[model samples]
Target: MGVGGRFGARESCGTARGVLQRVLDADRGVFETVARRHWPGADALLPRLSRAADHGVLWFAVAGAIAASRTPRARRAALRGVGSLALASATINTVGKRSVRRARPLLDVVPLVRRLEKQPHTTSFPSGHSASAAAFATGVALESPGWGAAVAPLAGAVALSRVYTGVHYPMDVLVGAALGVGAAFTARALVPTRDQARPPARPRAEAPALPHGAGLIMVVNSASGSSERALALRAALPLAKIVECEPQALEDELERAASLARVLGVCGGDGTVNAAARIALRHDLPLAVLPGGTLNHFAYDLGVEDVRGLARALERGDAVRVDVGMFSTEQRRGIFLNTCSLGVYPELVRERERWAGRIGGWPAGLLSAVRVLRADRHPLEARFQGRTHPLWLLFAGNGTYHRMGVMSGRRTDLADGQLDVRVVHGGRWPAVRLLSAALAGPLTRSPAHAAVQVPHLHMEHVSPGTLLAYDGEVTHVRGAVTLRKLPRALTVYRPMP
Candidate 1:
């Protein structure tokens, strides 16, 4: 996992465990009374608080001013404090909630004793109400230390009420407190320091970035899944050129992409991506994939999805060079950027084509798939990188594999210059195999699975041309096609993210 994701996860687990430990051990009835005594039942307060926080968090900080609204000066100051919390809630809390979906005790484990409270009955992770309250209180106090003295108690009470009412646990309040305080502090810091008179100097300005020189040309089969979305992107990134291609127009599209966009972007089915990537070497362009089709394995791996996002990325997306794979038969040469499937997968693709034209989407797709999946074996002779044995199903992927419909294996580093291949041997029948084995999330613990890394791959069948698919398209080849690697081949639009 990335460091940011890992730290966020670790923070979540620690917070949840700490909260649960308190709740699981605490005397439940007592906890409820304590939260209630602070300012009556918090049920009435939280719903309103949550709505305001969604709008902005400054109100949470300003609640103290509301609590002490006797003098006109104090009332005005408290109102401003509320505004700040509102801003903080909308900008900081909302973003943080998505980043850390820590649930509340009531939502997770403890059952609430209902009493007519209006708390949200949704995902209880990290309570937004608590955080907003804490942050607003913290900011108001910072603005005027005397304000802190009054709001601090209120903030603590609000956080505690969540746990006491059985809406949130002790840990939920603590996380909310920390989040609020942190957000208030961060906003304070990010904003210009009110006390400092002389401004801090900024570093010298850098030169405007030079043009990347060349971009990837996208050839989309608009009829495929999301490629139809590309039309919206042209307006966003005027620099990008789009070529709508049919199955037979692969070569012409490749030629245009090679000449125009240095990196060829494909928006279509896996077959279309493979077809373009197959002869990419001869055309001499790198292949950038857009997931515009159903079951987009190549686009999924590429990390570029949806046309709007793709257009935005083009404005700031980096053009990173990645390695390409080659597949060749005796007389024909092709590219397999996603995977080359045998047996069930190859046969499934063929059978589904007719159904695809007939019934649309997952309904027809599922029915067609059940036919191939229900069968036991598709006997075929295969080898990996020229050595292996006679295997039933051998899939040579550019990198990675799938199990029970889930994408499996490490997302291979596109620039690593290696192909990730998987060999599967299943004896399970249709319904049985789908249910028992790969259906659940996560790869099967330790099945008869092996991953091999090879520079070159070749496959042959007993008869003339066995059904071989790149991505998922079954193309007509003379007899054999050689798979080769192309370094720094295509240019694609991708953001740093």
Candidate 2:
């Protein structure tokens, strides 16, 4: 090489080293400045706050409180927050810490009062606590703006505490928080938020514009634990007749209300809504659903979230026609607004109901799942498309259910006039087969399960008294049952954009 070429190469190398040294000097300078600063109340608060966030105890407690509100949206927000936190924490420990093996800052400049009683022993390039805080806050905000706003202050304080307690540099907290936000977005990308894919407001229908719910009669299933929502509806619509009834009296009261009212309204879970939908269909009355139940699948898909949402729809006279699903036998017929399933799921539902009253709902569901999966039960024998097969589960939704990341089975269109039929083929291990089917995507065929979209599904020669579950309710059917869609059969109230 010539002398000039060698000198030019040396100069470039020297310039790169100078820039790197300057960056390091600036980083250390900022750390020292923060360490020496005195904030009035931080000495007493920041250290304890940092300790509370250890092992995510604070976040988990917050999640439990949010879920205890018993609203579907709140629960979802809580779940998403935890999911994002998990992703961020995993990435920080696995990749962020390992990739950058930077040393912790010297504590000589930091105030003794502000320092944590026990210092962090890990590398200090990126802050794990800051990442968790940012991820959780961002995730909650994506799902629910109000909850996110409520949580943001705490998340910020936690992040600030990392720096105030001499545990993380400002850049560490900043980069960690950025990575945390990215993790939340990544989780949302995997499982899109409800606002990301709202159901289409199509096939508009005509319903009376009941100002203050003048001619509306609503039935509240008291047994379904919707008294609070019923009261809210009453306060919102003073003229509306709100009848609260027990489980046994729900049907009778709904029938009476439908006969007397210009509009039929119902509050409770999916089961109560299902009953109301049937009466509304028979009387040809437009239905206004107030979601007062856990997992209000049908009402959520219809875009009716709470009492206020339904109230706005009623006042605005905004309504849409949606398809209803029907499963009929020679002797009996029933309709489902969400989904209908035959097999282990129905058995699981029955088992859950039996134990739900004794041990509470969540625990009972877990027990039921374990019992049903462990029980010595044979698969259901049925004929599908001229072929007889042993099936562990046959699920048919009123509309096509789409997968959102790890979370599957959410519908974007409720009036597509098609039934989503998913079958988990019989296998030796029911739990393994069910898990595989759940993880599989829509329309993807695996050894354990297969999914298809069809206008209708016909099953022949089923055994007498085969259990069937539809929209959280269980029943029995036998001998040549057919599942079909009633296109745009039900008119429901929803706030339109």
> Per-residue lDDT tens digits of candidate 1, residues 36-108?
4544445566444444444344353455536564432255346535644665466444575577554544332
Can you give the lDDT of residue 172 in candidate 2?
91
For model 2, which pairs clash? none
Instruction: State the TM-score for model 2.
Output: 0.90
lDDT of each: 0.56, 0.91
- Ten contiguous residues with the weakest lDDT in model 1: 197-206
The window of 10 residues in a row where model 2 has the poorest summed lDDT is 401-410
How do the residues 212-264 of candidate 2 rate in per-residue lDDT, one tens digit apiece? 99999999988778998988898999999999989899999999999999999
Runs in model 2 lying further than 4 Å from the true structure: 1-10, 373-378, 426-435, 446-448
TM-score of every prediction relative to native:
0.54, 0.90
Task: Please report the TM-score between candidate 1 and the true structure.
Answer: 0.54
RMSD of each: 16.5, 2.7
